[model samples]
Target: MSNTVKIQRPKIPQDIKPLDFCPNEENLFELCIIRDCSIINEDIHRIRFEQVIFKNVIFKDVSFKNIELTDVIFDHCDLSNTDFRNGSIHRVEFIDSKILGLNLSDASLGNVFFQSCNANLISFGYSKLKQVLFDSCSLRNADYYESTFTKVAFKECDINEASFERTPLKGIDLRSCTFDRINVSINDLAGCEVTSNQAIGFARLLGLIIK
Candidate 1:
């Protein structure tokens, strides 16, 4: 596979009509099927999506901050430039979603699974992530600075240019994952393995001169 990441839009259903109002209980079923639809330049502040299945939906430039989601599945969604900042998500699965330019800073994630997703440039700074599995996701340029990770795994992922500055990396194995130029100041990198360039990148994060 080429390293060039291509941007693909989410595939929306043909039968569903466009959502003109804030999400409610009755119309949520139809809205769930409306994937790849753009919510640009609009404010979706504090909309609660409980037990919702948002399959293949595209949320661009929308704000989902301070919202509560439970058992919601966002499959194959394009969440680019969408803000989930300070939201509460539980038992949510983001499968095969394009999460580039997504702002998840200080969000609370518990029992969340992000499988085969492109999380490039997604920020998790100062967030609370517990039992969150980012399996086989591209986390390039993603920031987890000062975030709290518990029982999290980044298996078989490309974490190039990701920032973990001052983030705790205890027991986080980098053997299965690949890194290109991850920033890692104040992170425990003794057990992590890297190439020559990645080693230099780690040192640069620490501001240390390698001999």
Candidate 2:
């Protein structure tokens, strides 16, 4: 286990700035209030984001590697092909965002809230998540293999073809969600809780003869 944590350095604080362009190489963005910005192809590495609000921003192909996001709020942002690998997220909220092909593998999330986000093909493989809420999100082809989801709730999310294979889910709940193409064996769905409609959809896709 690599415990080499990266600490965010304190810089001069200011109000939210509108950035049109971003860095092409690896850089550290600390305590910068970047709102309504669009950063493309930036390698954001080992930085700390505090009290920052990235509202209506578009981060295309950005890599958040080994970073820490604390007290940050990403509202109505578009994060496509962004890699959040090996990062620590705390007290962050993602509201009404579109996250496609985002890699959250081997990361740690605590006190996070994802509300009404379009998260497609998100890889949460081998990650540790706690006190997270996914409300009304479309998580198609999301991978949760070998991840620990503690007190995580998918409320009104459409998780079609989401893979939860080999994940230890003991006390997780799925509320008002659709799971049509979930890649799981019949034994994997045992000891899990779901609504009647979800069960029917799972059975129909698996060709199970439900009497």
Candidate 3:
């Protein structure tokens, strides 16, 4: 089976300037561009960012709960160990970002793209993802328990030791991805596309000897 599906890229704003400090009263930011900024160890909650472009930004160990992100593009950013729980992220793109150990539990993500990102140990438990694309990302040991995926694509990703319990992967293509060990039920793997070698690997997972 061929994996020729192209992921939808982010729609970035053209006219944007260096984002200054946001007003403390309102956590609402729109059409702003933030680059080379470090907001590490900061607790930012209930913030709403619209049409924002973050490039080479560092948000390490930041707490970003209950945030709303719309039309956001995060390029070459470090969002490691960031708490994005209970957040609403729509039309967002994370490209070439280091999002290792990021927490996205109970978040609602729509039309999101995670490309060439180091997303190891990332958590998506109980999250709702729709039209999301994870391309060329290292999602090793990532957790997706009880999460819902609609029109999601995982292309050329490393999903070794990833968990997908109670998450249905029907109609999802896994031909371009590689996984040595995955935690998934047989029923959840139904209607999923895989390569011949991957099929053999799956057979081994089922304790079947393939000659």
Candidate 4:
């Protein structure tokens, strides 16, 4: 029951040099490897990636405003509907990435690690996630409004209709995650650690007629 976040793996220096996402010359990219490029619908602003490694990059319908990623590693990337608004990601590693509707609104992520990512409707509004780890991620309809989570972890995530409104799922651990219907409330489900049929489907979503 511990998601003790520790993702700092991307201090790459195996002589990587294929960096080419040129929106008019250098945007401070260091130790690079950006392969199989396809930057469609571009508006790349304030781009800065360090210790970069992005294989099979696509980034369709790109916006990428105020971007600055450190120790990046995005293998098998697509980044569909990529906006990444006001971004400043650190220690990033998004393996097997698609990142559909990927727009981290007002973003500021640290020690991020997302494996097997699809990330459906990924939009962390007012985002600020620290030490995040999401394995086997699908994250259906993800949009954590007013998002601010520290040491976040969701393994085997699907998160059906996900929307943690005014997000505050303290020390969240959704019991090896797999959501049916989610749009969190009830004081953000204090110290949320669900299972046992997601606490009777959250007690019938607070109607409480479960005999």
TM-scores of the candidates in the order shown: 0.76, 0.81, 0.93, 0.34
Model 4 lDDT tens row, 1-211: 3544676776778988896877656767788798997878878788888998989988877887989999889998999878888899988899988988899888999988999899988998989998899998998989989899988888878989899998998888888888788898888888888888888988888899887
Q: Which rank order by TM-score, best down to worst?
A: 3, 2, 1, 4
lDDT of all predictions, in order shown?
Answer: 0.72, 0.75, 0.87, 0.86
Tens digits of per-residue lDDT for model 2 on 1-211?
A: 0111122222234665654344434343444556776787777677667666777889887887987887777888998778889988887888899888888899999878887888989888999987778878889999988888666777778888999988754555664677666876666666567768777866875788887
The residue-level lDDT of candidate 1 at 78 comes to 85
Model 4 lDDT, full chain set? 0.86
- TM for candidate 4 is 0.34
Q: Residue by residue across 1-211, what tens digits does model 3's lDDT show?
A: 2333344555666877788644466888888898987886768789888888999998866897998999999999999999999999998999999999999999999889998999999999999998888989999999999999888889899999999999998878898899987899888999889888888887886889777
The candidate with the higher TM-score, 1 or 3, is: 3
List candidate 3 segments past 4 Å from native.
1-11, 21-23
Cα error of candidate 4 at position 194, Å: 1.6
Ten consecutive residues with minimal summed lDDT in candidate 4?
1-10
Quote model 3's TM-score. 0.93
